[model samples]
Target chain A: MHEEPLVRWDWIGRNWPNIQVLLEDHVVMSLVPIVVGLLVALPLGLACVRWRWLYQPTVGVMNVVYSLPSLAVFIVLIPVTGLATRTTVMIPLTFYAMAVLIPAVVDGLTAVPDHVRQSAVAMGFTPLRRLLRVELPIAVPVVLAGLRVAAVSSISLVSVGALVGRGGLGYLFIDGWQRQFYTPIIVGIVLVVLLAAVADMLLVLAQRLLTPWSRARGSA
Target chain B: MVAGEGVGVNWLIDFFGDPANWSGPDGIPVRLLEHLQFSALSLLLAVLIALPLGLWIGHTGKGALFAVLSANAARALPTLGLLVLIVLLMGVGTDIPVLIPLVALAVPPILVNTYEGIRGVDPELRDAAYGMGLRGGQVLGRVLVPVALPLILLGLRIAAIQVVSTATVAAYVGLGGLGRFIIDGLATKDFPRTIGGAVLVALLALAVQLGFTFIQRLVVSPGVSERQAVR
Candidate 1:
């Protein structure tokens, strides 16, 4: 049998502004890792692809790093980075983003057909120029797909940082659990899922906008 | 470098070196066992549910959409959030609240990988096995399972380490695990204990990773593994 209604709309309407702030915090924490991860991973992933020997080791290290729990990473940094600091969450989050993104970047670049790469080289495109003008653009969709996973997981893990004090929508879950109230927990789950969906959609949109040729080739 | 402020390697060594910390109800060994118990049970339950479901779906090719959707949905669900939410509903004091979420967290990889691995089997091989008058179950157990073994093991590795790491969240529910050190240390402001716990948990995860990698090598089909080696 079902229990009382968990969705408290009137309560949500009353606390709209506070909810808005939490949502903003969630988005900020989530997006920062994606941007930082891409900046760091792009070059590292390129180097791995270029060097060939570096790929396995890089991925192996990333897997190990990826396996570390987010909460532990946050708590472990408290003495060094201090609790409630964005750096504590951001640094570990960035590492996680890199762990997922680097492999995605490598896969995307490698997925580019070898003949296509050779033709780009034969066209007088310098190595850097080819990567920028040809390979990277082709790799965009794959990289963005990986970005979605990194982004969504970061958004979820950032909630764990709430245990230290401040993190976005996660505080609601903590508060609700402590008080045994369902509203905040329900609201947090709903809003967090909505945020992930919206973020995923935005990335999809960005991929489409950036790669118009993909659509054209698809139709042809 | 300060006596009480910095949690150095010496601090970890000293924390671990203490004999008192290894033998009681609250000792490191006890907590480590508790953590392993929680993680192992969660992994076992997850495998029980996901493996068969994944195999069935992969074998049938029906409900493939459900597998994708569930994997994505599971990924998006925050583990901590789910744990707390379930606790609130179940009225905690039992491990069920904690185990439920951990199981939820563990399932997606196992299910997705098993499904994908089985589906990726060469259609011709599948057809040949069926043509040989083998029953559906026989084809799946003999042909699909062997071919899909590497990916399934990979999935298990990912799931096992993940469950081990995330099981630390069990401490939040007032359950005993290695996370007690981190949580209790933070509450009492014991920097050494906190850092020591975090290090231990990391090491445990790394050990699990190593153990799984070794198992994967031993269990993977040598023919399939040869191809991976060449690649």
Candidate 2:
């Protein structure tokens, strides 16, 4: 048997169109979850914070959800969402994002010191105004930290969706493996890693922009 | 959709209720064992490598930045991609391909948690240990490890759950485990088997989580756990 090269540039050149579509699918599938997860988790996190007892149970459930493998979850959802559909992938990804983000949201909100909260109130700030202008902004750094983790993990996990037929760059892994080729697998791994790094850098930049006062505090 | 949903649930039940799945080389018992074997081996390897490294870095306070960066980087590496890439590179007829990615997946949580746990220990306690004539190794083993026990255990727990869950991917590469049912079923269009396998993996993951909670309770010192709880 002839030894195959680690990467065949010609193969990549021929397959660039398919690869680009998969890449776009991957980005959309991964990013939607983060945006939707934040939308859902904010209120849920607020509820947990408002009712302190709810926090533990919510975290407990989220941890259980988090512990379940993404592949397994994707398969299990096939009944309702059907296979190879974006919804099948996005639904679970959203839950996974929430699992990480909800805790982050709570922790970020709690990180607001008592005096800060009182001062906001002292300055005639309403509860809603205080939360919007004071608390959420203060929570940005911690929330962004969690968002970075969630974002990176989400990007990495999006590939696993390939098993059920929706894995973005993950499809390349399957393609390369079945054909006993290396180009797609190598490309897949590099692109996924690059996506994670880019997502993480963007979140860090967002944190820097949003929380300029906490510039002294170093990276996690 | 409703009718199809009913049939799906029935198939899932029938898949579990059938005694044939309980026996033979392809049985649930065997696959479960394989899953555990892969997970346990990967975790053990990860701990062996990570624990010492984490301990050294934590005790010395050297290379903290490296530890943090590597853990973050490890987290970002797609497990499926890593598994496929390794299998492609190594030409899988051995378990090494599967184990590498699983170990890589398990290492970050353990390494980061252990390092942070040790680093987070009170300096006054370290002073007390040294003032009592304890050497560096003695201080680390007696005072630091015990004090950091809760976080270390937490790290192990996280790693264990992750390994167990991700170990399902072993089946994708022709290795046997609970995931064999999933990957094989999906390939053969066996929805019941796929769902059943998924259920088993989720249960195992939960069991691992609960098992670690029990271990954490048993191993962590009451004083330390209490302090953590208060914090």
Candidate 3:
């Protein structure tokens, strides 16, 4: 049982194209939902701040949605959306992202100090200008933190798409299990973890670049 | 009037209505028991390992980095991938693979929570405990643990819900758990069973979450609980 090497170089040598395709598919599947989710969550999060009462009830509902098992969400969607299309995975994952990211966005925006908002107003900034320039810039660290989480989770979930034969790296898992192939299973894990790590690292780097003040504040 | 419809409500009703579906080797109750068994055992093992390590680190004010790193790493792991990898490594035919991944999934929350909870204990309390002639162990037990109970319980709740939900993956590895319905149903084009399984798993997760919340309210000290609520 221990004799077999964990990764098979020969298989990779023969099948680099297939591996590349799976990797690309995985990245694409993971990223598309994050992008879409951000677009939705930003506006919704802003609205939450605008209407205070909407915050608690909406978060409560989203929490329930978030707690629903990811697989169940995928399966239950088949009735409404049908199967095997990219939308099947995209819809549920986008919701999951919003569930996490909305609160993050809200918290991030709310965390922006009142003095910062006052200074922006004192400088004659309009509501739109204030949100875009002052509030958002300051909230970048927290929002990006939320984005990092959403991205990592979405990447992990893309594999669950394999249940419907639509998973990216997930395909490798289901197929490897059926064929009893150790190489693909190990490869898939390495690639997924590496992808998650790389994605997280890039987000962290983005946070640093976008909010140099945060780094300064932290060090002080 | 049409008596039936395609793969929707009627199928779900019929799936649940069948008495055979509730009492057999592969019945709902048995699968639920299997799912709960995996979750409960994994949780027990995780708490045993994480609680003490977390408490020690928290008490000594060390290993904060380890706590954060472990929690982040655990979250990034794809539960399905981990389950399959362990099964492949262990060479199947038993429940070890499933249990291993479930425990792995459960540990970080409890570990991080316990560490953070213990660390969050007010320094004054620790000094007071010492001033009153308490030893290290007594200070931890009498003062720290009570104060840390809320966060520790929060961690347990997170781990328990997670294990309960993800335990369904066990069905994929030819072991019988609640996931069997979804995997087997999909394989055989049995959409009703698939939907039923999904619903059951979701309900179980929600129930566990609610149960933990209730337990948290009942057990956490009122003073500490109020502080938590204010936060």
Measured against the true two-chain complex, the DockQ scores of the candidates, in the order shown, are 0.58, 0.75, 0.51
Candidate 2 regions off by >4 Å?
A216-220, B1-4
lDDT of every model, 2 decimals: 0.86, 0.90, 0.86
For candidate 3, what is the TM-score? 0.93
Pairs of residues clashing in candidate 1: none
Which parts of model 3 have CA positions greater than 4 angstroms off? A217-220, B1-7, B128-133
- Compute the lDDT of residue A133 as modeled in candidate 2: 99
User: Sort by lDDT, best first: what order?
Assistant: 2, 1, 3
RMSD to the hidden true structure, all candidates:
2.4, 1.8, 2.7
Over 4 Å off in model 1, which ranges? A1-5, B1-5, B8-14, B229-231
Name the docking class for model 2.
medium
lDDT computed for candidate 2: 0.90
Report chain B TM per candidate: 0.93, 0.96, 0.93
Backbone clashes for every candidate come to 0, 2, 0
- Model 2 achieves a DockQ score of 0.75
TM-score of each: 0.94, 0.97, 0.93
Candidate 3 A-chain TM-score: 0.95
lDDT of 3 by residue, A64-96 (tens): 787788788788778766777678788888998
